[model samples]
Target: MAVTKAKKAPTEGAPVFFIMLRNMLIGLVSTVATTLMGAAAKGDWLIMLIYLRGKDGPDKALPSFLAPSTNGTAEHSVVDEFLEGYGMKHLHLFILMGVAGSFIIYYPVGGFWHWYYYVKRRDQAHEWKCQPNKFLTKENEAHAVMMGSFNMMLGGTLSGTIACYIVNGGYSRLYFSIWDYNIAYTVLSTMFVFMLNEFTVYWSHRIMHMPVLYKKIHKWHHRYIQPTAFTASAMHPFEFLLVQCLMAAPIFIFPLYAGSYVGVLLWTYYYGMKDHSGIIGESQWPWQQDVMFHDDHHLYFHVNFGMNTKFIDMMYGTVRKKDREYSEDIFYGFGREKTETKAQ
Candidate 1:
């Protein structure tokens, strides 16, 4: 059901600080639960595959859970059994796991966010939607979901390949021990990558908005005028590749603790889903991001080009203007009015 509301000044009630904290906790809990579920499911799938493979063998002997080496004299753990059974190297297994885990984490978390904000609390959250009067048609939602799934699979594989290449070529400054430098340095490095991600997203996204590029590439994503969590990835393949590159770029550029590097990537992803989500409220905490910022970009087009942070847009004078009417020309850019009207 679509949550519709009349045009009026947004009534502020609950403190945005409390709201931000609550949303953060919900997102974190959802991610942890989904991650555990994905891990367990993956383990079971491996076990099943190993068992079935043994069943198809000449002797039909069940594979041992503890030691399932093909040679009778050799000893190996279940992990080794699966790796041996599939004839996969450790690096190959890592890439497969990375791709599968990305898909598992993305859809489930995005679905939960949609259900929570758009279904479970639609009326309660009506005032918070960036465009309360606007809604995506059922067909649009379905298209977004299908395209998002495809993009995730493609993007995940590309990211895994990039990660493997970086590791294999010894190009990345990734360190395993947190104390390789010091705890303070680890924290500082994470912050550095985090900001670098923001910078890259801002510039890359802004550049994509150029008339020629937007029409050819970025326009696929902007088709969803009223975006949901799923719409976060309903972008062109080239754009998806760019996103993968953006996530991997920081690792090659500077020193980063392994654990914190993963954390930074998660931070960027969590915020990406939230930003595209139509759920909207002004950010109260200095570090908290508001959905309205990016949602407005989809709605107003050619403005509010920054993600996760509004400071970049503010610095560059691209933020949507409050004094202007909501239209393509609300904030000026070359060929702003010439941009196609949003898809219905």
Candidate 2:
């Protein structure tokens, strides 16, 4: 049976500030954990490859994460030089690591976020859910996870291939760390990357909504019309490619430091999950729109293709303001729902 809206219920427990804090921590920890896992997996794969070649340690200067030393000199795997250096010098190794790393990181991160919000917080689940009465049935949930997991793998492969190519081309500046560059460059580059991403995402997403593309490629994502944190990365391969292309587009123009690149990756994961989180919260900032932006896209299917930000959407006139009382969908079969409706 099609689910319908339930009666609005009162918000309980913590104040808006506390709820936001708790939710933000969950997201932050999840993203950082995923990134760390990816790094560990990448290192492991490189180690295996080196061991296969009868090498045990890196043969060259290492990145910041691996080169940390006490006396201002790069410290490295003194006993495992052959193991680390060969892969660092080879493009294929990076690509291999990237593919493995992506899967290792995203799948669990998505699942954990889903369980934390949807199952663990059962009492506040509906209140937080953006789309009421729109939970994925078991079959659909499985499909979403499967597709999302595949997309994460694909993203890893593509990103890894790109990293290999860039590093091999002798662009050392492209492989910098947060401390390698001055604060001004890091801050400015971060902002620029954000702007570039918004511009590309806004246009690519809007174009995909065209009927022909939507029917063939984007439909898989819309299956989770009421999106969960897991659904953020869940999408048709073509759609993931399209989005990742835009995301990686800036690399052609900018030589991003390693820390900056990691920062972008983390921010992408964070915002993507937050936007898909069904919960309503205090705006806090004038520029920050409620979840309704993307939530409406899933619920109504026609507007709000923008990401978390509205700069480009505002300029292009594609933003769709969600109805005040009807922002989220029904969570359970019961006739009542919890509303966090704030004055628009």
Candidate 3:
């Protein structure tokens, strides 16, 4: 009998087919969860209202708790108007469609970068494995599905509910529309949200790195050191809420002239997913410099802390200059020694 040596797994090339497949599955489950959650919540609310009405005659029931008043009459109570205007039939469908449309459009455009550019370029020298690796096992797939669904559902539900309250006050015009294409408005709003949310993410992310917090709130996300499409949303519920609130705060505070608000929100989601996509590729055009800054931070922590831009990092000398390369491994303390060794 002859003894044989074990062969090492291939480490190169884009997991194109599998990556896309995973993305599709994650997107599908996310869409379903979002739709079901919204519908169920609305249904439960309706049921509760009906029960209350039965217990206390319609006239005696609290008017504030009802839906939006359609009689061109302003109700004194907030609940009444909320109930009257809340048409579960169309609203639920609209929400489901909107969320589904968002993932469909966003993932293809922004999500494709990882497979097309980053993975293809980075893994050129490594061997290609046809089947899923240990990291991409069935368990990982399930985890990713749960993470994606929870992230989207939680973020969308919270933001949409808040928007419901604000929009009901005659601010429905803020929702994004096809006809409204104001470049200036879009740019300004995007920048504002990016700037504000960056702080929120940075602080929350930093906290997650802390020993105590990392053990609980943030550990699940970091479980995927080399993240895949599904790893994007694999975070704890508390982490999700904190980050989503930070992301949504600007939108709530700022009043928009047109429906560009929706565009801004969508843009945030698009970029947020891309940041976690584990891609590091250059954009096509000259002005669109290769800013894999955020994803790089996730891959090689402490280098790219800033979310959307490098301005603040650069200003504070925290920006990891490309010339000063860093390693994916090694927890060499912070500053010069860490940076220098990693760069080497």
**Which predicted model would earn the best TM-score?**
1
The C-alpha TM-scores of every prediction are 0.69, 0.66, 0.54
* TM-score for candidate 2, residues paired by index: 0.66
Pick out the ten consecutive residues of candidate 3 with the lowest summed lDDT: 41-50
Candidate 1 at residue 67, lDDT? 26
Residue runs of model 2 more than 4 Å from their true location after superposition = 1-92, 170-186, 255-258, 281-285, 322-344
Model 1 stretches with alpha carbons more than 4 Å out: 1-92, 120-125, 163-170, 282-284, 325-344
> Compared with the true structure, what per-residue lDDT tens digits does model 2 show for residues 193-266?
87677767777887777667777877778788777756776788888877777666665676665556556655
Tell me the tens digit of each residue's lDDT in model 1 across 282-312.
6755865587888878987888777778887
Backbone clashes under 3 angstroms, per model: 0, 16, 11
Write candidate 3's Cα lDDT for 1-344 as tens digits: 99997775653354888768878898776544433332221111222222234223233222443323445344334444455366221233223433453355334543454355445654442332211232355676578657766666655455444433343342332334433656676677666665566666655676566666767676677666555555666678888777656654554466443334344444444444444554444544432224356655555555555555556556556556555545434222133554566576
How much lDDT does each candidate structure score? 0.64, 0.58, 0.48
After aligning candidate 2 to the native by TM-score, how far in Å is the CA of 277 from where it should be? 3.0
* Shift of residue 175 alpha carbon in model 2, Å: 5.9
Candidate 2 lDDT (Cα, 0 to 1): 0.58
Output the number of the lDDT-best candidate: 1
Flag the better candidate by TM-score, 2 or 3: 2
